[model samples]
Structures are given as structure tokens and as C-alpha cells.
Target chain A: MSSALHTVSATDTLAGRVLHDTGVAVAECYQCGKCSAGCPLADEMDITPSQILRMLQLEMPELDDEVLRSHTIWLCLTCEMCYARCPKEIDLPKVMDSLRAESLRRKVAHPKARDIIAFHKSFLDSIRTCGRLYEILLIVAYKVRTRHLLQDLLMAPKLFVRGKLNPIPELIRGRSHMARIFQRAQRKDG
Target chain B: MTMKMGFYPGCSLKGSSREFNESLCAVMDKLGVELEEVPDWNCCGATAAHNLNHALSLSLPARILALAEGAGMQEIAVPCSACYSRLVMTRHELQENEALKAEIADIIEMDLALNAVPINVIQALDRALEGASLESLVVAPLAYKVACYYGCLMVRPPKVLRFDQPEDPMTMDRMMERVGAEPIDWAFKVECCGAGFSVSRTDLVAKLCKPIVTDAVKRGAEALIVACPMCQSNLDMRRCAIKGMSEAEAHIPVLYITQAIGLALGIDRKDLGLQRHLVKVALPRRAVVGA
Candidate 1:
């Protein structure tokens, strides 16, 4: 959700190495359907989490529209039950994350998925300046972006009055450390 | 010197789960553990973000880890189950491949020192619980039958997050014992709670929650203990929706980690962050910490 104002040209090859990065041996996934069977969101999908990973293994470039736009990506709760169940220990969520990122790049998003996206953008915006999320700013941005500006308005006033809504966000004392942290993480990997 | 792990509390604790953080700080300090919240950390992209964008998903948690390594803190403790899982997975991925680390570095413009530190909430809890006996530190033990709920986020999608054994994680149960509560052995430990649907799809949440709650009650748990805020909120707030589906009265209270700790520490009800809760506790008025 941190805006890639820092976009690069073919800079993120880590997407490939993420297979190794996750400690999940993707090669261990021998087309076994255990992941498909264990996935609560699998039956409702045309491309199961396992299939997506299989495509990754086979190096398939083009993904189906149903798989890209459906709430299945959003439906994955990241509980990691499937990873433990996988005889190969493939992290389905990691592969799903790659698929989700691809969907974002293609601008193929679910309807309600936009509202959630708004929250993501809002969240990063808060951290970019200060080092953490600002609850008030986040909710305000989420409501405004979704055009449901008044959904939690009443609750906001009550929470603010309770000293719970701190106006000043707890950002890094000096952002030099913050910027370096971002720069360093983008560089470190599997 | 004791170990000092970097902490990233995330937005929920800064807002709704503040009391949980407060109690965590208290109990940890009393136990001689020092937790330093990561300086200027961001959201771990939560459940919704990663689903929308995978690269960005790793990017979110990796960003926080990057800061901890900068501060010379090798390990990071994330309290929220979802954040812990994502951060841990991202850390694992970053460490396995040099190319990926270089790529993420290119995206965020920083070098991520991809060491294999555990980015887990329970792992952190396990470390925190070390050298301390659960039975010895109780002023107010939660003696009720408690169903330790994992609620999907803590365990799922084998590839990205392997926080526990997946099918049957016992971290929560162990913590419950330290708090003097009887933990229930149940099948739904790794089940889904229709996450994020509490706002988008209430019916789905109710449908998923009813069974989990019914099963917990049937197993004799007076309340549910959870590590994730979203799960706690959904399971607690959607009580009416879940209750409407059931034939019998649903009377179990859903509690967060710190709240349970607060009860065991005998903190007042108001201080325990109970007011914001949706499900009412069965305990008497005085026993509600920080009420």
C-alpha cells in the first residue's frame, strides 16, 4: 500500500526468490491437491491457491480473469492452515500474494475490494510521514475515499472525547532512520 | 542483559486495542521483559492489503523488520496474529533469496538485512513467558473454561505463514494455563471467522461464527480467548447476529490476549478495556478489569 512513487524498472526480481524467501520449498509441491482440499475458499474458485502456485512453477504468465477479479484473493484469511497441511509445505498465501500484486498491477480488482484498498493506501500514507498509522486520519481517509463519510462519525467523536484518539501521530523522532529502514528492507532478502 | 525485541503494535492497538497494549506493557515489565515498540512502524498491510497485492504485502511487514534491524534489534514481536504471520513470512522469503532482497531493496530503496528472526506473535509470547511460571504470577486467574480460538489468520495458507503446526497450534492453550484458565480442546482452532466481512458481509460472518461459537459452548468454554483484534471484534460484536442463528442462548464472551492477562493480574475492569467490547462477560461487575 506504500505508494511506489519509488517505482523501478524490473527492480523487484525478489518476486521470484520469494518462493525460497518464505522457507516453503515450492518444488515440494508435486501437484498434490491437499491445499485445494483444505482451502475453505478453494471450492468457490476457478483457480485454486494450489493452481496459482502450479502456474508459478510451470512459469505460466497469463492468469484468468475470474481468478484475478474474484474476492478469493481477499477471501484468503492468511491463517496458514494450508501451508502446514501441504505435504510440500508450500506457502499458498505467498503465491496468492504474488497473484494479488499482479491483479493490482493489471487494475483488476473486486468491487468491495476498492474500499479495502482505500484503507491500505490510507494506512501507508499515515506511516510515510510519521513512522506509524494514525487511526483518525486512516478512518477519515477510508470513509472519504469510499464516499461513506459518515459511517463511523458518531463513534469518532465519542472515542476522541475519551483521549483515545491522540491527535499527534507517533512518527519516528527523525525520519532519516525511517527512510533508511525502508531503503534497507527493500534491499535485504532470501 | 535481557533481550530487547523490536515491537510493532500496529494501528488497532493505537486505537481500539490500546488497553491490550497497556496490559501487555505492564505484565511484561513485571516479568522483567523489556519490549520496545518499533520506532515509526507502518501497518503490516493487514488481511485486505496482501490479498490485493502480494508484493506490497511482503513490503508492508518487511518495512517494519527493516526498522528493527536498523535499531540493532534482530527480533521483532508483533502482537496481532495477522501482522505476525505476514511479517514472519516476509522475513523468511527475504532471507532465502539474494535476488528478492535486492528487488525489495530497489522498491523501498533500503537494504533489508534478511536474518531468520521469528516474526510471530505467539513466538514472542513464548519467549516472554520463558523463565516465568504462569501459576506463580496470578493475582486474578481467569478460571473459566476458555476456548482458545485461532480464527484463521494465525494459521492459514501454508506457503506465506507457518506460525504454528497449522492444523493444531497449542500456544494459546499454554498461555491460558499460565493464566489459570482451563483451555478447551476443539477442532475449529484453525477455522475461519469470515474476516473483514464483519463490515462488508455480516451474514457470512454470522454463518461462520455461529458454528465456532456453538462448538465452543458445546465443548464447555464459558468464553473465547483470541490473539487477533479483528477476530475478537467480529466474534464479540457479531454476538446478536450469531445468536439469532442459534436455537439456544449464546452467552460466551470473546477476549483479547491482554484483556485476559489483565483479568489474571487482577487489573480493574475499566482498565482492562472492556467497555469497547461487544459481547458481555459472564464475570461479576467488580471482576471486569478497567471497566
Candidate 2:
């Protein structure tokens, strides 16, 4: 199949609807391959960072390739070295970011994606309500999401006994602001 | 005039490494900088999701960036190297990847200010150290030979990062000396130590860690001062396995900059998250005053 540039739409929340409205210029990428050379996890990437930037410059998606599969999408660490190193400054991590979100919205997300999403969701949920990340909630949700409850369970007793964890969360005063922000931000996207 | 910082310690300093937080506060206080912790902060995902799924990881940090923008702070100081990397990297992506930004806005149901700047501890420290002549910034010299460990998250794949050389970064080392500390020049500073995978996959760490520790010790670092919590925890906790495969005992202490700051500030040992450490730590005799 040939790569075709799709027109960005109002529903186009990810590709070109930058909040600032000016959008990032992908043409800035110079194909330095430094993004490729510096990627620690490039071995697992479908196309290297340099290739990904080049594909973006050409307005083509690097979604195909069996071994390079969606698995490569997960392999990008969002380290920003590629962007910092790209002579053209192609925003390689954002491309990965777009592809990764697309993967989940399309429901082809790796099984592990849900677990990661859940951990983050619960992390933010704890913050949205409490106005700060509830450490206990964060760890519990992470362990629960990853299905590795026992991994950090052993540390809870020590943390609890040592007064490291506030069993009761520290609820902030301007708590309503947090919820309101979440509500409005969520609605804006909707 | 006091300079206010939007301090984002990520998950580690709040949960596991309290001392690092305490030390950082004390040290920064001496520098006349006050870190106002963001009222509401979320996990930056660190090196985990970036390795697992790109979009999920970017949005995870982007959402927090969105929240920070909602909080009204434009420049935020990130203490964790991993969190800093994720936040800055996500900022770069959201700015340059419009299509990706649109997709994320759709998925997260929010508009993240891609312009929200993420500054690392090195940058933050540099900011805090601003105005004061580097000569006058030295409170107590961390004269001990310290291995400045940046790990893979700090510098790699350069498109989004621009502070220093990936293979050999000197920003942290140069900063260390400004604070009266000796920074050991060592290879493997940017090597990966299996980070979060240290649990799901132990062998990966053993192989990665062996070289990292060996290189640090071989270079005569009295200890390693790390900007990344994952690196500090991994390098410290996995010492047994690393040493099991080695011919000599590995007693090097891995200290978070926060912990080192606590020590330099004459804070109590109990305040530095020292007891939480698996490996035994030997604080300098001068720092023993607080305990």
C-alpha cells in the first residue's frame, strides 16, 4: 500500500490540532540519524528514529513491517535525544507519541498498554481528587495494574511502620480546582 | 527577592526517597531558592512506558504537562532524571508533532500546552545557582570522588535533548565541582541498568550493572551521585547480584543529588532516606553531626 497524506480534521485531535494552533513543523528534520544512533532501544524500534523522522518528513506512516510491528511503538522511550539531536529537529518522540495513542484508540494496543494506562489513570485520578498523587494509591494501583502485587507488598509494612506513607491522604484545600480542571480539560478534548 | 520553583519530584522522592527530598530542600535553601511543590502532580512514567509504548508514555507525561499548564507554571523543575526526560521529551513532541498532538488531545480529552518547558535537576540546579558566582556557591565541598551517573535517560537519541554530549556529558560533573564535589570521569555513565525491568528481568540488570559498577569503581569514584531515582535504586539494590558475578566486593554508595544535598546541608541522616537504602551508606564524619 502506498503512503497517503490524510487531511487533518476537527476530530483530528492528535495529528495537527496543536493547542497553540501553529503546530510543529516536521520539515525541520535533517535526517541526521543521530536520533537513530542515540536511541537506546532502537533495536526494538520498527524503523529507527532517523527513519521515523524521514517518514514523517515524507508524510508517510511507518505502521507496517511484521517484525517492526506495533511492538516497536512501545519500544520508543520518549527520551527527546532524537529531537534534540535531529539537525532538522523533526520531533521523533511526538511521532512515536501520536502512533502510540493511535494504537490504543484503534484498540490494537499491546495487552500491556491497558496495564500502563490503568496505572497512569489511577495515578492521575488520585491526584485529581487529592490534589497530589496519593503514594499509597499510586503503588497499590501500579501493583494491581501490573499484576505484580507481591513485588512491592513486602515494602508496605516497612513504609507504613516507618511513617513513610500517609495511610490517610493529604487532601488539599483548593481540591475543587483540581476536579474542575480535569472536567474542563476532559470536556475540551471531547 | 526569593525565586520560586515548581518542584516536581515525580514518584520516587515522595514515596521511597524522602531523604533526597529533605536534603534537596536544605541545600536549595542555602542557595536562597524555595521549591514550591506543584499542588497537584502526576507520575512522569520515567523510562518505563517510553520503552513499553510511545504514545501512552508521551500522553502520560503530556497530561501532567497539561495539568501543570492548568496550574499556571510555565517553567517546571523536574528532580528525577527519568521524569525530566519524559516531560521535556513530551514537550518537544507536542510542539513539533501536530498530528500526534491532535491524536493525543483526542485520546486524553485535553489540550496540553506543548510549550510547557521541562527543566532537569542539572538545569534546575543551574537555575538555582544562577546570579551567585560559582565560586561563592560552594557551601560545603563534597570533596569525595563521586561518579556522576546520568544513566541512559539523561542523554541519548539527541533530537529532543540538547544539554550535553550523549556519550560523555559534563554538565552534571561541572555542576558538582561548583558545589565543591569531585566528579569522577568514567565511562558507562550513559549505560542502561535495566531500570524498571530490574524486577521483571533480573539477568538483564546483572549484565548491564556489572559494567556500570565496575567502570565506576575502576575509575576510583568514592560513590556515585545519581540524578535518576531508578538508577540510584537499581545500582544500590542490585549490588548483591552484581557483586555475585564479580571478583570483588562492591560497597560503593549510590546517592541521589537530593541525598547529597541533605548531607552537604548538615541535615540529619534520618532525614535523607538513608535508612531506606539496601546497601549500607557511609556518610562523611562531618555529616554525622545531624544524626
Candidate 3:
């Protein structure tokens, strides 16, 4: 609970870019504490949701980088609980989402939350290839990436026995079209 | 009595939660609503796409909406809450920002009509079966108490989803009552089930699932009911790791709302995919036809 704002006048232009991109009124947050108070994952976050907004208000790129890289951004479930309870109607989940996108673009990874990053990357990779998720492949890819192969091992047998896990993903006819969309998105970003 | 609507059974329904897909189709088929699959549908970009790339999220869902529109469906039913949220949110974004919509169109390389609105399974059920006689359809009434868990995405960011009351939604509860199941009043109805983190952060998901599972059990709920695949998989599959849960408490069945409805409608247990759950599900004594 750092009360003093860490203002950095040098980063105002970058801060303006964030505000324009997210359309969040970072200044209107007022650090009312309502958002964090209602957030389900606030206790696990390095900085509270209210504090994230406060950092944005201060426009400190260094603090912004830390915030973006903290496990908090990836840990956010995007559940919208904070947004629902916020008096200012700030969409904390959306803010977290935008920050996460920024984190990816800047190649900033949360050391503690790498598994989440890996999972997200693996998920998008699955979509890019098959146009839809192949559950078995996604699990294997994630397990290989995280190297936690034994984790949730018991459930897989039961899932397979129960016919929940399909050995193959039904490939949609428009996979090439989907690949084109991903390419265009990445090209525009570069 | 027959009405046609497009069904977008996102990846989860097609793979991990085939039971939800089966039960929904079975229930709808019984009700005489024809659900045509939105042909050549791809992933909806879900939470991952949105967090990693803005344009990809919008483009992935926009393509599906465009396909639904091309097939002449004014509205399509997205059973998975995450997919429903992505579709609804993308549509909302496209409607608000013409520039972004144009950009997304350029990337997706398709002219989306943006008229194929998205509706969650519950909302779709309400519309298609409006005023239908459910009282006669209940061959096996689910008389036991259940907790209706909405999870997060189905009805949140109220302005964007605009589906149900964000804080204290009761659509699922009301639907439960139609099948003679009493939906208990609980605090964590709209709580987060730590979705998408099921594989990445199973520990955190178990911790987050604590309140929802404990509250339901503490409130005398025989089962927990849900619509979202992530919520179902997390709460059901991760029951072993949930804090303050005992073997007895862990045995509480996590049922899809559609599965519960399917039970009430006397659809065969096999047809509803009830065997697919990690936690074995057995209908309560009251749910038996001649009980």
C-alpha cells in the first residue's frame, strides 16, 4: 500500500499512449480502493488494482514496466469483479489485458508467472495451426513447455476413459484463412 | 414449433466438455429447435488472444459472426461463456469503433456484417423455448437443491455483455426451478473460477474455487451447476486441490446447467455425456422417474 505517487514527467507521452489505447480513465480512479477490495486475486497480486491505476496516473514508465511485468497482470482472470464494484466503473480487467498485450510486445515476462505466459502462447499457437484447439496437443505442448508432465496426470486417464479427451481436433476448412488473419495481425504489429 | 438457429460450440465444447455440447443439443433437439452448426467456425481467440493481441481477438470472433451472418442466422448461440463473452465484446468493440472494425476487416480479409449478434446458451434457450411447456417435459424431476454458478464472463462488464444482472444473476436459478431443482442462494454465484489458469495455474484455480465450492456445500446444495466449460473443468476436475474440501464435499457433482436439464427431461444418461465428468455424477434419488 504505497500511498505516495511515483510521478515521472518524462514518461507522460508513453502514458498518453496507454490511455488512448485502453480508454481507461486512469486519473479518475482516485485510488478509492474499491476495485482491489472486490478483486478476487488482489491478495496474490504484487500491486493492487487500485495501485496499478495510480501508477498509470503517475505516468512512470519504469513503474509501468514493473507493473506490466509483475505476476499480477497475468494472474488476473479478467473476471470483471473489480469493474463491477468500481464506483468509477473502471474496467480493471481490461486495463490488465492491455498491459499484458504491452508486456508481450515489449518481450517483458513475469518470472513467477511464466507458466501462464507459456500457456497463453501455446493456446494461440494451437489456434494458429488448427483454427481450433486440439485439447490433447495443447496439453502436451503446455506440459512440455512447463515441464510439469506429471501434474494433472491422474485426471487425464479419467478424462480419456470418460471420453472427454479427443485424440484429434476436427480441422475446420478455413484454417488457411485463420493463419492469414494471424499473419496480418503480426505484420501490422511489426 | 421448429425454429432454426446457428450453434457455435467453441473448442472446449468440441473437446474437453463434449457432455455440455451433447446435453445442449439433446435438450434443444427435444424442444424442437434446429441448431445448425456455424460452418467452418474457428476458435474465438478467447482470453488468451485478447491478452496477447487486440486485433487477433477481434478478428477471430468477427470471422465467426460473419460466417453466421452469411448462413442467414441473425443471432447465434455460443454455449461457452468465454466464447460468448469474446464474441459479444468483439461485436461491442466493432460497433463502437468503426476504425477498429475496418482494421479488423482488413486483417481478417472479410466484410463482416456485424449483425450476427451473440447470445449465451441460457439466453438462447429462453428465446427459443419461450412459453414452452417444460412442466410436461419433466419426466425425472431434479428435486434436490443445487447451486447455480454463473462464473464470470457470461454476465459481466455489464455494458458489454448486457445479458443478465452482473452481481446477482438468477437466470440459471430460474431455469433450474423449471426442472424442479431448487437453486440455493449463495454468495459466490458470479465469482471467478480462475478460468484459463486451469492448466497454467492449477494451484491458484484450486484456491479461487474454494469459496464457490465451500459456499455451495455449506448452503446445503447437493450439486454445483454451471454453463462455462472452464468453470466446470476447474471446479469439477480440480476438486481434489480445493481448500477446506473433504472427500465427501469433493464428491459433490459439478453439473452443466444443460446436463441437469437433460436429466430432468429424461434424456438417456449416455446421450447427455454424464460419464465424461472427472467427478462421477449420479442423479439424486428425487431425479429418478418413479421416485
Candidate 4:
């Protein structure tokens, strides 16, 4: 029970890691709730944007874990609404990005985030192979990963009829260069 | 003599929102601007890269900027607002941190002079017009009520983008007015349209787009004018998903800013890709004399 009362230093917390990764000090947020007030998806999020910051501010291991596992990080559209309206100018989206990365690394991303993660992975994989986004390939891969094959099936033919969905992707000549960039970026991330 | 400008039509332009590219090209061609495509550009990584790996996001856009710089282009026009935001954010990040810029340069294997700046569609068109009013070039003015939806990426993080008023941006509205269209003041102008989740989280996208579409219609806007591909697609492509919207409300067409301008310039409907939209785009036509 005494362990629950033990104070965790700011530098030894998830907020510290966020600060180190993004240079956005979560401690600067004074819980004005302005971020939550402006967040477009606040109603849908399991944890509001400002609450995520408050969790970080708390600097407890349990709270830190909660922040990492919360669906708010995945739900963020990176629209910068919170950052724009935040009186502290905390750049909450940047912090969310860091939290998302950490969440994936720790394998504790909310289970509901599966589809979103699948879409992102598929999107990146398309770029990795073709240098540009191959929408057809991305959709196929996403459907395969999410097992939502029937989903959006009706819209595909419509897009194709509109000349929006091309059968063959336009490949850039600098394929090898793009591969090299991806490899180096992965290495840097590791 | 037509002015040559560097053009980076990001992935969405080539795929999901080809109409945006078509209309943009048609309008620019009429405006005496020749779009020079950047040689062998790759994806800017968009939301995925930044969400997963920060270095990759910076490296991808840095590579495009480097290619534009190598081509001796002073600035490149990015029509997609998402790509524009990524490129501009990369520039701002690199400018702020020399070490990160060097790291990104090493990753992309380029000198990264960062000379080639990115201009969004509005900025590009504004520059192409060269201080002349759009009314001067209009052959068929788009005389209809419109809600200019700036969406999220184009105007947010105001300190970095520095292009318009973050909350109540009127640049697009002013442009629409110049083209003889009535731009209405409405909420949800700079709101998010649940971008990047169109494929994965359709429910969320529908819920987010509902307010934007409803507000525009409630304000009696004939069409929702947008500069971003994601915004247009979310509002137009996902209109059917927005539950409880009346049949008439669901039919409100979302038009790309370039499409509206192309119509005012008297560019052919097919050339502007007007037939490509899910919702039929039939603006109330009023007679106007070409200047």
C-alpha cells in the first residue's frame, strides 16, 4: 500500500520518454481541458486528449500504461485541433504520435485499434513496394488484414467507374532509392 | 507566355481523387500556368509514417524537396492539403532543428538544401493569378452559394503553415467571391473530416462528416467547396454513410476548389472531371458576360 503513495520523478515516467522523443513537455499542460474541448473525436475516444496529458502529468507507471493502451492515441486524426486550441501550445498530436509508436512497440495498443493499425501498415507497405500509394493494393491488403472483405465492396466499382481506381499502379523510376530510404528510416527507428 | 511552376500531385491526386488533379490542371492551363511534374517523386508517407516513424515522415518529404531543388525549381505546388501539410511541416521541423535535418538528409541520401518550398493549391493559384482578380478571367461565373471548407491540415498549427486565419479563414471564401460565387460563413470550416480513416473506420468518418455536411446544408450552402482530397472524399464519397441525412441533404455535392474555378473559367465539364463525383454536381447556373 505504501508503494502506491511513492512519488515517481518526472524524468522517470512516460511523459519523460515523450519529452525525449518529441520535445513536447507534457508537464506544460495545466489541465485547462482546452484540448478535450476542441478535439473532434473526444466523444468517441476512450480517453480524451487532455486526460491523456493529465495521465502523463501524473507520471505513475499504471497511469503511463493506461495512456499507452488508450484508444485516443489511435483515434487521433492528427488534425492539430488540440494543438491549435491548446493554451499551453503543447503540440498534443506530436505527443500522441510518440505514444502510438510506444504503444505498438510495447504491444499494448488497444485491441479496437486493430483496423486502424492494419490500414496504416497496409498504406506503408504500399508505399514501400510502389514508391507511391497503390490504393487498390492498399484496400486489398487492408481487407485481408481486417477480414472486412465485404466492407466497402460496393464503393470499389463506383470508384473504378469514375476512373479513380486504376488497375495498374504508376511506378516511380526511383524504386531502389525509395527502398533505401525506407531501410535507412527503419534502421534509425531501431 | 505561360508561367512554368513545379507540381507535386501527391498519391491521392493520382488515385482516389483524380478529379482534383484534372480540375486543377484544367484551371491552371486556362490561367496560363504550366505544371512541371517533379521527377521520380515518392510518397510523403503521410499520416502513416508520422504516426509510426517520425524519421521516415521527414525523410520522405525531404527526398521530394531535394528532388525539386535538384531540378532547379524554386518552389513546388502541392495540390493535396495532406501532402502540403506534411511537406510544410517537414520544412518547419528541419528549419527548427539542424541535427534532425542532417539526420533526415543522411537517411534520404541527399544534400537537402531545403530551397524548394511547398505552396498549397490556394497559394499556387493565387501566385498564378499574379494580383489579377479571378473575375477578370471568368467566362462563366460560378454563381451559387458555397461553403468553403478548409478542413484541418490546410490551416491548423497556424504558426507553422502561416497561410490563413486558423479559426475563420476567408482566403478561399474571398477567392470564391472573386469568381462571382457567394461564399457563406459557416461552422466546421476548419474541422476534421475523419481523414485517413475513410477505409479503416468508415463509421467514425461518417459521424465526423455528418456535422460538416449538415452545417453546410443547414446554412443553405449549395455545395461544399474544398481544397483537400480527403475532405472532399469524406464529405462526398462517405455521404451515404452519414445516417439520418435527408435524401436532399445526402445529395449535396462536394466540389474541389479547382473544379469551381474551372467552371467559372468555362473549362469543359468532362475536362474538369465533373462526371467523376459520386454526387451529381449541378450548380444553379446564372448568365454572366466574360470580361
TM-score of each: 0.78, 0.70, 0.95, 0.96
- Report clashes for each candidate as comma-separated counts: 51, 37, 0, 0
What ranking emerges by DockQ with the best candidate at the front? Answer: 4, 3, 1, 2
Better by TM-score, candidate 4 or 2? 4
Report fnat, model 1: 0.41
Instruction: Say which docking band candidate 2 falls in.
Output: incorrect
TM-score of 1: 0.78
Q: Per-residue lDDT tens digits of candidate 1, residues A46-88?
A: 5677775555454333444555676677666555657667776
Query: How well is each residue in B147-227 modelled by candidate 3, as lDDT tens digits?
Result: 999989988888778777998998999999988888899899998988998888888999889888888988999999999
The most accurate candidate by lDDT is 4
* DockQ result, candidate 4: 0.79
Error of 1 at A129 (Å): 5.2
TM-scores of the candidates, chain A only:
0.67, 0.71, 0.89, 0.93
> Between 3 and 4, whose TM-score is larger?
4
Please provide, for model 4 over A1-190, each residue's C-alpha lDDT reduced to its tens digit, 9 standing for 90 to 100.
6334333334468987887777887777789998899898999999999889888887799999999899989999999998988887889999989899889888999999999999999999999999999999999999899999899889989999999898889799988899999999988875
Off by over 4 Å in 1: A1-33, A42-63, A110-112, A149-168, A173-190, B1-5, B52-55, B106-111, B115-121, B156-164, B196-203, B240-251, B285-291
lDDT of 3 by residue, A118-187 (tens): 8888898899899999888788888889898898888888888888898887788998898899999878
lDDT by residue for model 1 (B130-166), tens: 7776667788778777889987766654445645666
Error of 3 at B84 (Å): 0.2
Using DockQ as the measure, which candidate wins?
4
User: For model 4, how does the per-residue alpha-carbon lDDT over B96-178 read when each residue is reduced to its tens digit?
Assistant: 99999999999988898898999999999998999677888888888788999999999989989998999999999999998
Top model number, TM-score: 4
Worst 10 residues of 4 chain A by lDDT: A2-11
